[model samples]
Target chain A: MMNQTKFEELCASFALGALDDNEKQELLRELEESRPEQLETLKSYMDTAEHLPAGVEQTDPPEHIRAAIFKEIGAAPATEQQQDEATPPRQIAPPAWIRAAAVFLAAVCLVLLYFTLNLNSERIELAETVEQQRFEILDLRDRVQVAERYLEIIGSRNTYLVSMDGLEPSPSGFGRVFYDPESRAAILQVANLPASPPDKDYQLWVIREGTPVSAGLFSLDVDDQKRYFVLEDFFEEDFEGVDAVAITLEPEGGVPQPTGDMFLLGSPS
Target chain B: MFILFALLKKLTGDAQEEAELLIAVAGKDQQALGRLYDLYKRLLFSLCVSILKDRHEAEELLQEIFVQVWQKAAAYNPEKGTAYTWLVSLTRNRAIDRIRSKSWKNQQITDSDPDNKILELIPTEGSNPLHVTVAKQRSTMIQQFLNKIPDEQRSVLTAAYFEGFSQSEIADQTGLPLGTVKSRMRQGLLKLKEMLSGKEDQI
Candidate 1:
């Protein structure tokens, strides 16, 4: 029994989602008897209510929601028209040979891709193997040269053998140096030495009158057979100026002066 | 500007289009339904999210709303209101029902909103890209209108509209008498109607 203005007011709240449930039911009952003008007013109020949330950020539903909605209603999407037009019923099925050709092409492509991939990996592995063998060959040639040099230094008439004994740092370590004063070439042969830490290398230092000069660095890894290290450009000074040859664990590359614990020291026998 | 004009023209004709679209939907014209969805998805979705405050729940409710629209498209009476009004009513009722019945407020959008296989919603109008722009425009107008309303009245309307509070609940929340809440709500809504009327005439 609501008056026209009261009913309209309640309809406005109803549109705004503020109407009580009981009052909503009452509104509906009034709705059945409303004239067109009244309903039009109600509609405008509802539309106004709809717009009231300009403050609430408007968000588009996820696109998948569109697909989901179409799926739920069993309706084709708007894009279906073009898709339908593009695909005629009669042309839906391509020629059987075309299908076979497509399948064959796909299979051929897959096989080619598989073989190409396999061949590419094999080529890389082969290159790596060749590279490894090239390095090994270079290393073998260098070893042969060192052995020849060691022999030449050992057999030289002016060659002198210096017996080296282990220091406190490596009591069990011992080594020998053969120097040919004429060629100023030297070779070191050592054994029973602890492995070098990754950050440290064994450096050979030649000390003369308390002034030590760096000989060179050598790594001790693998078997004892390849223990000989040829000292390149052995010394800038004459052999007579050399007082002693000592090996120490220095930084990766040898330093001009010995700063680490001496592992071995050698002088004239 | 041209796009805005096109949308306005489209919205102007929306009364008939919406009715026709619903009729087609009743006849199970899915394309028609899709057209309708394209038109109002943003507006209705914004309303749903505004009420539900949970995007997931809003999305689920949007699906249910569309499904309900499909099932009841035939029952739609154009004489009662525009198609927009009908869609809004459905969205509002369902969202409010969820917030109230499921204790959506108390339950924490744990969103135990059971995965009911609900049907979809949307419209059968043709492509209209400006629907989003149109929603934004209408929202801007509403904001201006609300700002123009007195603070007390605007507050009551906002609480009632967004919070879905009843007059008595609003009275309690605002610490105002029930009679005062009712008066504020009526006056605010009357102002809204009047403002909208002036806008439509301008258009």
Candidate 2:
């Protein structure tokens, strides 16, 4: 007889389905003659071994695999036929009152269907209206934010406003630059500028000492009803010396250097 | 005592339902076969994929196993084991057999490294919440138990149970001695049984 330790070892392997043929036979013999407690222990081991796959994610086989399998086994059509045979036959020749009731129900169904179709169209229209209103609200919120910042800059005691004279590109154009020394915040508002060319943009540059730093690039909507194009977030960095602010018409995506004609220039007084 | 009785009743009820289905399947009731296929397909498919590491082959084997279930339902003996255990064992055995075949061996060589392959095949999407919760809880409990065992022993146990690797095969794959693999598997199972028995005592 195998020792208890060796027998348990074989049982564990047997539970794991890892024992070879010889060891399997030996384990089978032991299991056949084992006491109840020993059998329970082996069963527990098998139970735990079975649960090892519980950690693995459960995946459904492809939906058609079931159908394919049924087809292969010639069971799909047979099941359908069995189901049909098992179903009771439909009733025919209803009474007069029942026919009248059926006609009334059909009329009610038609009315409900008509209302449902109408309600669906109305709901779609309502959804479109809501979406449009949401976009309008968002646009209004953005404009209000810009107006609030503009008012703050104009109202600040420390802010200095500099006016720019129209230059060669557009003599009728005018611009204003607002700077707050304390907050180092600036905003630019330009008016009456000619519409930029399709391939060109209006670039703002701030001269700090001698070298000019590019502020940003923008293009105006000539067709817009608003007269002033307010450029928020004009300059992020603080420049110490008070100098000139200039606008140049350059190719789309402003050049590193001012490679185009200056459209507006203003030097702080 | 009532709770114990209720639990036993539920288990027996489920087994009875399965037994009836199998009987119908044995009598060539195609609908009963389909019903049986739907009932166990997910669990069996997951087990097959974990061993085979290929969804296509796992699905093919799944169909073949169900066909066998249809043909061999009459051979099932309720006195020997529960229907769930019998079905799971049949799937695992067939999957292991397929992996041991010559063509499968050659395919394994051309495939990616076994270590990089997903050892546990969990679905990433669209699983039922209740099923997911239950699976998670069971998996977490199993992981906690596995954590108690030593690393080498745990690896051998996992290779044998999840990958269906035999003791000698685990030794070959891990480059460990066959005796070491055997000892580790035995120690791992003992530790798991002890832990589970402790839990049962608490309950």
Candidate 3:
């Protein structure tokens, strides 16, 4: 036991935060060893010395302080403006919806004409079958090319690879991917996806073995950005034999086995 | 010493959070810098006022502090001291430098309020007011802790805290032996800490 009086004096000094570093340490050490009462006493003082009563609000910060903070945030580097100037002007000749409707009408007319011609050419069935098979092959080839380009992007250091395949609702719309592997940790992007319902959202999953693990949930913001939904993290090698990457429209937090329709799937190639 | 170590650990832990914020500021996230400013503004402002004694000069010094904080956030090393200690030291140094600068000779201190010198900050008056309130509360606690010390000892502490003076400088100003001033200052702080601890338990 050290002198209680001296210890109390030290505690007072400590609460005021006046002691030098070494002196503070020594006093606290002595208080800890010899006097449990002083230790408890000092704890109270420090605690009270750190608390504040309620209703002590700052009425207002000077408006100029607020302005300076905003100005600093908005002062983008001049290089950003230069970069914006380098882009070519966009041509806005016709509305996109009107152009889409015109294309749809033209397609309808072409399909009707094909059906009439096919009805007349009943004797040439073999040639028609061969042509149909050739067209199917061409479509498959295009899909592979698209998938390859997506893989190239995924391999970049900036993106994490996420795989999702069909599970429940709309099982056939399989094999969608999401990636966001950059320092910015940006928003998710989806690729090779089909249209989803207005009330539903497309959730990305990192499947491990037989389980559907949610990487993140995302929806398309614009038509131009396409099916690419930026996701959180990639499915590392731990997800071996992941049955298929699946997307389920769950009530936000996503589900274990995918409660909603499995909109898409991508098996390891 | 053990208790002091624990106390330092608690305070410094908070500093680490600020250091992380500083890192965010270096990335030019103005909001993070604003949060940092909000965290330390009161103590920093008080410290400036304590030395400069002019609100306007202190306000200008506050702007200079942030500018330096922005420019040098990358250089701060957590290993040197807690973020709070580092920041307070920085603010003190800047205020001392401002006082000593050639500009001080040209401008005379007037009776007019310095609130007019407040800098224009960001426009969005943020959502989290609680953080600033908590910091202010903590400063009040620290102030109360200072009040418990004897007047003679309190004067020495006030000089050290406000003017950023060394022990020898304090001794020279007060006409006391350097050793006597140092010991009294040391003893005064120890006693204040004890009183604060006892007062805290009563609550």
* Highest-scoring model, DockQ: 2
Candidate 1: regions farther than 4 A off? A1-17, A21-50, A53-55, A75-269, B1-10, B102-136, B201-203
Top candidate on TM-score is 2
Model 3, residue A52: distance off in Å is 16
Give candidate 1's error at residue B145 in angstroms: 1.9
Give the range where candidate 3 chain A is weakest over 10 consecutive residues by summed lDDT. Answer: A49-58
Q: Of models 1 and 3, which has the larger TM-score?
A: 1
Clashing pairs in 2: A57-B122
For candidate 1, the per-residue lDDT at A184 reads 85
Fnat of each prediction, in sequence: 0.43, 0.57, 0.02
Q: Any runs in candidate 2 off by more than 4 Å, and if so which?
A: A28-36, A77-269, B1-5, B102-150, B194-203
What digit string (tens of lDDT, one per residue) describes model 1 on residues A1-269? 67876776676676565656566666766766666566656655555565565546678888777778777877665453543454354236788899999999999999999999999999999999999999999999999999899899999998878878889987888999998888888888998788887788999888888788887888776433227778757886777867888989998876767889998998865
Tens digits of per-residue lDDT for model 1, B1-203: 57557756766576667777788888886766776777778877988898888999889888877877787799776654457656765676677778777543353212222111000111223313222123435666676787888999988887777656787788888899876776777788778768866664233
Candidate 1, TM-score of its B chain: 0.73
Per residue, candidate 2 scores C-alpha lDDT tens digits across B101-184 of: 734334331224321121112122331111111122355566678787899898898788777788888888889988788788
Candidate 3: stretches off by over 4 Å: A1-61, A69-269, B1-16, B102-134, B199-203
True contacts kept of 2: 0.57
